[model samples]
Every structure is written in C-alpha cells, then in structure tokens.
Target chain A: MESKIRVLVGKPGLDGHDRGAKVVARAFRDAGMEVIYSGLHRTPEEIARMAVDEDVAVVALSILSGAHGSLVPAVIEGLRQDGADDVLVLVGGIIPKADVPALEQAGVSRVFGPGTPLETIVAYTKSHVRRR
Target chain B: MDERYLTLSGIPIKNCYRPDDTRQLDYARDLADPGNYPFTRGIHRDMYRGRRWTMRQFSGFATAQESNERYRYLLKQGQTGLSVAFDMPTIMGYDSDHPKARSEVGLLGVAIDSLADMEILFSQIPLDEVSTSMTINAPAAVLLAMYIAVGEKQGVASQRLAGTIQNDILKEYIAQNSYIFPPEPSLRIITDILSYCAKEVPRWNTISISGYHIREAGSTAVQELAFTLADGMAYVEAGIARGLAVDDFAPRLSFFFNAHNDLFEEVAKYRAARRIWARVMKEKYGAKDPRSWRLRFHTQTAGCSLTAQQPENNIVRTTVQALAAVLGGTQSLHTNSMDEAWALPGEKAVTIALRTQQILAEESGVAQAADPLGGSYLVEALTDEMERLAQEYFDKIDRLGGVVSAIEKGFFQQEIADASYHYQNRVDKDEYVVVGVNRYQMEENVEIPLLSVGQESVRQQWKRLERVRSERDGQEVRRMLEDLKECAQSDANLMPVILDAVRSFATLGEIMGTLRSVFGEYREPARF
Candidate 1:
C-alpha cells in the first residue's frame, strides 16, 4: 500500500494565535497529507512525544509570539534526545531574517517567514518527507 | 472592460440604479429612522455629530506594570477608552511561572495570571473614571471577576463601571483556538456571565460577538458577517434557554468586527450585519427594547493584512481600513501598528497607528455624517446581496443545530478552511495583489527595525509569579480552588467562585485545572 505523507502541525508554547497554523494544516490536507494538529499550548516535549508516537515524517512548528529562540531549540533537542532525528523539522511564523541562520543551525530544515505561500510550504514538505 | 461588468456583491454591474431598483426599499416600512427599529443606516441619528466614535486603542505588552504604563500613556494622549490585550499565557489562563509560560511570560500582549496581575494592570488608573474593554474570551469569566475585584479595591460600586468583555466563545471554536471547555459547558459559562452581568455589572456589555478573528482567519467579508451573526444568535439562544429575559440582557449585548484591506466589501458587511442583527433580534427573539435590536459594534483593522516586508506600507493599509470602519458606522476602532507583523508594536509604530485614526477623524471628511455611503448604488446593492447570502448561512447553521453543533461537526471550521485555501490559491497564482508580498518584490532587503522581546523579560516574569505565590496564603488558595471545583459541578454562576479563587491568590492554571476536571478538555475532530 502506498503511504501518505504524515505531518504533525503544532502551535508550541503559550502563543494562542493559531490562524496561520490552522490555515497551514488545511493547506497540507488539501495537498494530500495526513495532518495531525496539536492544538494550542503544547509543550515541546508533548509535540516530540506525539511525533514519535504517531510516527510522523515531518514536524511543523508555528510560533508567532517571538519565542522562537527558546521554543525551536527545545523541540530540536527533544527530538534528538528521543532518537527521532530523522524527522524533518520545519519552523514558520513571524521569524526575523537574522534568526533564520541560527534556526537552521539548530536543525530546522527550513524557516518560512511571513507572506510565504501555502503552496511553497506544501511543496517543501512533499519533497523533503518523500526523500526522508 | 466596462465597469458595468462588475456588480457590488458579484452581481452584474448595472448602467444605473433607478427607482425600480429601490422599489422594495420603502422608507417608512423597510427603512426605519436612525436609532429606531431596524437600525440599518446608523444606530443613532446624531452618530459622530453628537460625539466621534470612541478611540479605544488595544494596547498591552510585557508585564502588567509595563502595560499599565502604556495604558496611562494612551489615556493621557486623549484616548477615549481603554482596551486591554492580555499576553498569550494570560489569555490561555497560565500564570507567569507555569512551566508552559516559559519564554512567553509577557510576549505578544500583557500578562495577567491572577487577580494580583490584574491589580497591577490597573494599579494607578482609576477604575471609576475609565471604562475598560478586555479582549479575553475563554477565561473571560475569570478576567471579569478580577476586574470587579479591582473596582472593589478602589471602593467603587460594580454598577458604576461600564465596558465590554469579548466573552463570545463560539468564535473561539471557529476562528480562534483559545477555548477552554467543550461547547455545551462553554455556553453554560457564557450564559452564566450574561445572567450575572445583567444584575451585578448592570452597565457592562456581556458578550462582544466577534467577526474580528473570523476575518483574520482569511474569511471573506460575507462569510465573516454570516458566521458572526450565527455565533451571536447562538448566544441569544443560550441566554433564552437559561430562562433569562430577552429584554433584560439583550440591551447590553455588543459586537466586535474586523476592517480588512477590502474597503467596500467591509463597509457593505458592517451595514448588512446591523440590518440582519436588528431583524433577528426583533422577529426571531421577540426583543422589545430598541437598544436590544441595535447592533452596536467595535472595529479593529486587520492584523493579518499587515506585512513585515515593507512595514511602512501598513500605515496606508490601516488608514484605508480605518476609513471604511468609520464610514460603516463603527462604535469604536483600533488601528493596527505597522510593526505588529514582526512583534509587539514599538512606541513609534503605535503612535503612527493612533495618528492614522486622528488623520481620518480630523483631516479625512469621511465622518462628517452617519453612514456616508448610505445611498450609494454599488454599496446598497452590495449590502442587499450580502444580507441574502448571510441569511442563507444562518439557515444552514440552524439546520446543523446552531453554532455549537456546527463547531463539533467542524462545519464552521471547514468553511473557513475552504475560504482560506481559496485565498492562498489566489495569492499563489498571482490573481490577488499584495503590495510588498507578491506584486512589489524587491531584490534588496528592506531596512526596518523589528521589535523583539528579550529573554530577560521572561525571566523577570517567572520571578514575579514566584514571589506572588510565596507571599500569599497557600491554605487559602487550596480552599478557593476547592470551592471553584464544587461550583463547576453545581449550577452556580462561576464568576463569584472564580473571584474568590483569584482573591485567594490562586494561579490561573490552578483555577483552569480545577474546572477542567469537570468540563474536560475539548478534543477537535480530525479533518480529512
């Protein structure tokens, strides 16, 4: 049986603004993926645990409250510690250009800033998850 | 390429609107006088002529102390009313020191974890003199309790206070995701507040049924109007189901809407909303008070419309949206800061945002009379079309067992999903032109200072929450939580219980945790 690309879309930390995250989840579903959306206020540990338990191929973290520095790294460390480093981790939201390099270095496969098209995110997830 | 090819609400453009087009619009029968029954053109006859719409700028950041300082600043700058935006942790009902609140202690908006935080939020500001609006929904009952406690501390009667609480939880299920309890229990909590505020806080506006988040979620103007009115009607049903008198609390019901980049669509939406709401209140709910029938609303410029690429252009976007809101007869308006797409708006950006409203009121001649576009051929046609479409949505929602059932079945969620998908497809295909985002892409990076909250601020908040916990009475905290849990199980209004918990220094997380045992967490259905 051909497998569907699985993506865990989550809003980690305390940010309650989930419009972008919810929109992205729908866009992924429309693009033919089994998307698991962990609703608001999920900790980094919860997200990583869900990813491993659900056996998802990619983890998309959306942070809009300017806590990317602390949150992105926490998720990365949790995935690494749990030996789930094969998961393609993606981060998006109101990320500054200057923080992209640091986020990439911390194991974020791609950092999509504001105004990124849903198609671009969809394309990236499809290509990356298939390769993995 | 004739302009006649396009109609206002997607109807074929007409050469001109003659008496035939308006034959159905009888002045005495269809269109009542301003401030009278079926208030479509304007709520009040005087409108801005009596007084300009209240300048309720939503402002908050960092700690309660910092947000309070900004509130004082805006009030001193001639702001008419106060609108508070609580931080993410506070909105989710988490104390600053909660493990979940790490790194988000005071980011996005102000942090109010308990009555202590609420007290600090209004420390120096006089509760009696200023009417404050809180943009809180899921934890609205708790926040309102805290606000009442603040007034009590100031030795002011609750009846003397006046303002609004965005207590409309239905929107949380559809557009926003800040909900705490499941739908049935959430409605009970909302109805409880409606019943309580009608008696205790007599002047308070119980629920501001909001389309703001719906628009922010990328819904069209018509969808925003449709979904919002559906949510409002659902609340009315909840109140009536609880055996409350329609005239008793309906007079204080209010609304909050979003003014997006689509100028004419937004104006048409506001007018259609009022007409639809008035009819629903009178015919459907049997409301007697004219005030109960009128749809008084507050408007905020679309935060999602602003872009980080060319930050300065957001000012122009906000100006146009604000103008549409004023022309559409908004009771209050909040202009989005240019830098909001990046972080919490900086001082200069907030000043610029406030000035945009000032320019509209002072220089732009849009607010000289009530509903300036009342008789426009395009606008009137658009209004009629929107009203028809919105009524269709209401009918469908009613068939789906109202907003609560629709939410559980993901009906509203699916509609917003489809609309958001359509919008993204348009953007990707270049069918829609977003100035700096799609049409005006530049090779060189734009130089603008992005506002960033530092890590130190979060650490400070953690310490503050700890100090409050250590200094307060622990035994009393446990007792209040017990009371709250018992009240959650019983038919008692949760407001007084929440107030007791907050006064006893119970953390937001604890109060919410106690209730979660009874309400249980909401589990959203899978989308396929």
Candidate 2:
C-alpha cells in the first residue's frame, strides 16, 4: 500500500485532557506518519471502526481518566471484531507500571508512560510498522 | 552566561528589578483600580478579604448516584461549590449503551444521559442554594438544558440558577478535540446558549472561556494568554453576529485558567489576562457593562506538572500552584491530588487535595488582601512583557484569519509541538530538573498506595446503561431523534431540539452521531 502511515490515537473514556495525545499525534506527523487523531471521549468500538476504515497500521490509545483497565481490553475486542487484529496497539498516558503485563495480554503491543520520549515512539513506529 | 536560572517557562529572572524596570507601567492609567477598570489588580475590592475563593473541587465517578454521594461528602468537608466532571461517554455525547460507550459509560466523569441522570447527580443538593459548575462543552447546551430540566422539577426558577459551563469549544480543536459539531456550528450553539441564558438563566455563566488546558498542553504563559484571548475574541464576534449586545452577555462570560509551576509567570499571566480582556471588551466590542469587562476565572492546579517518579512531590507542586492561583485572585479553584500522576484520585488523596485548599484559605494569610503582589516591580514588568508577547501572537493569528484558521493551518498545534519538544529535550539533556524523574534519583520501594477505580465500576455502569436503554420509550426516542435531525438541517438552533432528545431519553452517541453525519469528522492538519 503506497500511502501515508495511518495511526488512530484516541481517548477511550471521560479523560478530557488530550494534551499528551495531541502532542503525540503532532510528533508522529512530524516524523512523517499519516496520523488520524480522534478527539476525546472515544469508545473502543468507534476507534476500532476508524482504524479499520482508515486502514491504519497502528492504533495508539491514550486514557488518563484511569479507566484504562476496562477501556484497553474493549479496544482490543473492537479491533478483533473489525478484523483489525493485525494493527499494532500502542497504549499510553497515566498507566500504572503494574498494569503493563495485563494490558499486553489484552493485546496492547506496547505501553508508554509520562517520561517516554517522542523520538523513541517514532523509532518504534518506523521499525515495527509493516510496510506493504 | 548562565540561562539556567530562568523561570520554568524560560522567563529570565533578574538579580533585582527596581523602579526602572517598571517605569513604563503607569499603575493609575494602565492597571487602574483593583476592582475598577481593567481589573488588573483584582476583580473585587475586598476579594479574599470579604469572602475566600470558593474551594470547588471537581468530583465525579461511575453512575450518578455514586457521584452524588461523593459530591455530598465533599460538601460536608467544607467545599463551597460543586464542579461536575462528566464521564467520557457523556462528554462525547454518547449514551451509556452506545457501542462506543461499552466499557466507558461512567469510567472517568459522571455518566449523564438524560434528566434522570442529571437529577440523580444533583439529588438532595439544593439547586437554588448552591452554585454548580459543569465542565462540559460541545453538547453544553444539551447538558445545560438537562440541568434546567432538573431545576424545573425541583421548583427552582431558572433565574435562581447560578453556575458556569465550560462552553469554550475552540480549545477542543486546539488541545482537547472532544467536540461534536464543526467549528462554525459549535460557535453558533455557544452563542445561542449565551443569548438564551442572558434572558432565562440570568445568573448563570454561559461560558468559561479557558486557557487552562492550553497551558497544560505545553504552551508557555504568553501562548496560553494569546491563544485564549484570541478564542475569546472569536466568541465576542460570534455573539455580536447573533445580534446580541456585547454588554448583555459579556458580564456572564467567565474564564478558567491553569496555574502551572512557574509562580511569578503564572501570576503575571493572570494579571495580563484581566487587563487585556477588559481593554478588548471595551475598545474592541464596545461594551459598557463593568461586569462584562471583569474577567472572573476559576483556577485548577496543573496536572501535567505532577511527576510519576516521586509522586509525593506533587503535593508540593500543587501547593505552589494553588497559592499562585490565590495570589492571582481566582474566584474558585481545584487542586490536583498527589496521586493524580498515578490514576484517578481516591478518597484519601482527594481529601488531601481539598485540605490543601482549605489550609490555604484558613491558615495562610495570602488571602488577606486583594492582589497583594500587585505593586511588585518584577510582577508588573513580567505582566507587561507577557502582554506584549501575547499581542504579537494575536496579530499573527489575526493575519492567519482567526482561531479556526489557526487550527486549520496547525498554527497552535505546531507551537505546542515545538514547546513540548523543547521541554522534553531539556529533560533528556538533564538541563531541566524534574526531581526524582531525572534528578535526585532515589533507590527505594514504593510506599504510597496507587488508587484504581476497579473493574466493578465498569460492570455496574454497563448494567445501568442497558437498563436505561431497554426501559425508555423507544418510539418517543425515535421521534425525538428525527425531530433533532430536522432541526439540525434547518436554520433553527439545535439547543431546543437537543433538549427534546435528552428529555425523550435519546442517548449522547445518537445525538453526536447525527451531527457527525452532518458535519463530518475533522481531519487534523499535518503539523510535523
């Protein structure tokens, strides 16, 4: 597929603060990836549907409202429902370190926290995104 | 040769700022009286002298009943007012049962779908007696309508309602992006409410024009002020376009600002914001109402400044920011819990956050006088510099057409990106110290408890939403939605129609989805 590297970044629950997510989207776009930024209050289903329709290679979920344990799995399930299991699921924003393993088990490929560098994210995306 | 001594926002501090530094500031002409024109010193003459700023803590949780209990608990703890933070589903205009709302019905903020939820959220809380501020926008009109519906049921006259809605949606495009309608239509909805509230809910604050989120998004104080005022100007223009007099609605217009770690810069920013807003409302919008010119704002301690490494330090960070907000003369405030960097604040942590405010109000003598830091040469100089920097940004944004155009061109996003990058680079290079995060590393096991909302909240909310959906009148909902779609397509404002939908138990998702079909989703510009 000769297209922009589409990534869908969303906030699954009521966490209205999107500073980190918006900054990440800008970082991705600056690194030459086609970013599809979903505004706040997105459900896992809406996000998965968007990822499918946009044919995004990566889905970055940002939840700061501390609803991640519930919302992260829902996003994974939604992706499965949309036949988007191949999409790399990356979760970030206020996630406790202890929840990382469970999130990984729930199909979140990677978890980034407050101190994660944007360059590291860009590097990871570039190396991991499967180019057609 | 050392730029290391600068303030957090990179404002260089001098060894001493004498009278020469503030010679340009004509206190009588530029700043004027504290409670008078410009309101640079303070909005009221007595300020904290007469009454302490309202300790309004933002509280909400899964389910309206649970949230109400929490609100009552906070009130019992000496909280002066109520600030409601709705859940993701509600903020995004989705009902609890919407497919998108599956696990998120009431996860973050309170889930409010109809008048029932609204009533439950405020149950036993006297609507007429206590002021409530709701942090909602995009569907603010719908939420306001639901609030009014609840008030009507309580036999409280609309005129008796005194509250504020975070109805500033322009920042949604800039930083948040939880907006439902397009910019133009969203502005229309905001104006419609402004016009309606001026007559009906006379004491209600129609919009809390904000710069809190902007500063949180990594912008400096100057950028926060510039972008925020530009958005406010857009709203003034929007109200004027609706054929409403500026003075009629501007008085009800309030502001919400973020108090960041930079104490002096944050204080100066607040002072600059007041003077600039007063001048603009008077000279630009031709407003005669003094209330219209005064920029009354609510301040929340910055959540971004909290470090996850040494979580305990957040208390200190919040105290500094909260004191700055008090010195800046905010009308009300919310201090972030220490564990905010970990997860949702638990009862214990939230208590401390509330106590932080209480201690400041009762113990600290900072609230003794209005704008105690008013005559400081350093603060005055910084205020002037901030104003000048902000005006430069305003001129640039105006040339790019307005806030909407700036968003379309990714102007604000790009600025935030650069600032975030700069801050991050400094952190990575050990140039900026974030205590335990990058410096003063401590090798120790975690001692503090991490607060989690738990899985039971999800299951319970899911069940409640399902019950509401199945039990509601389906036919009435369908009819109401059809009416809403019609109103959306027509020249009629969508507030009344949205109210009908909410009243008929139409879900948030259905309403927002209808508007999405009309406006289409916004595609953010490539800023990198």
The candidate that wins on DockQ is: 1
lDDT of 2 at B66: 86
Across residues B1-528, which tens digit of lDDT does each residue of candidate 1 receive? Answer: 553354222335566666566656766555566665677788999888888998889988887888889999998888889999888777877677767776777777887877777888999888888989999988888888889988999998889888899988889888787887898898999999999988899999999999999878767778889999988888898899999999988989899999987677788889888898999899999998888889999999999889888888999999999999999999999999988887778778888889888888998888887888877777777778888899899889889987888889989877876777677767778766789899987766666676666667667677777888899999999999988888989998888888888878788878877888889877665332
Determine which window of 10 residues in candidate 2 chain B has minimal summed lDDT.
B519-528
Model 2 lDDT per residue over B479-498, tens place? 98888878777767677787
Would candidate 2 be rated incorrect, acceptable, medium or high by CAPRI criteria? acceptable
Task: After the best TM-score superposition of candidate 1, give how far the Cα of residue A2 lies from its true spot, in angstroms.
Answer: 8.3
A23 Cα displacement, candidate 2 (Å): 4.8
The per-residue C-alpha lDDT of model 2 at residue B434 equals: 83
Q: Which 10 residues in a row give candidate 1 chain B its minimum summed lDDT?
A: B3-12
lDDT of 1 by residue, A31-52 (tens): 8889999877789999988988
Tell me the TM-score for chain B of model 2: 0.97
Backbone clashes in model 1, listed as residue pairs: B87-B110
Docking class of 1: medium
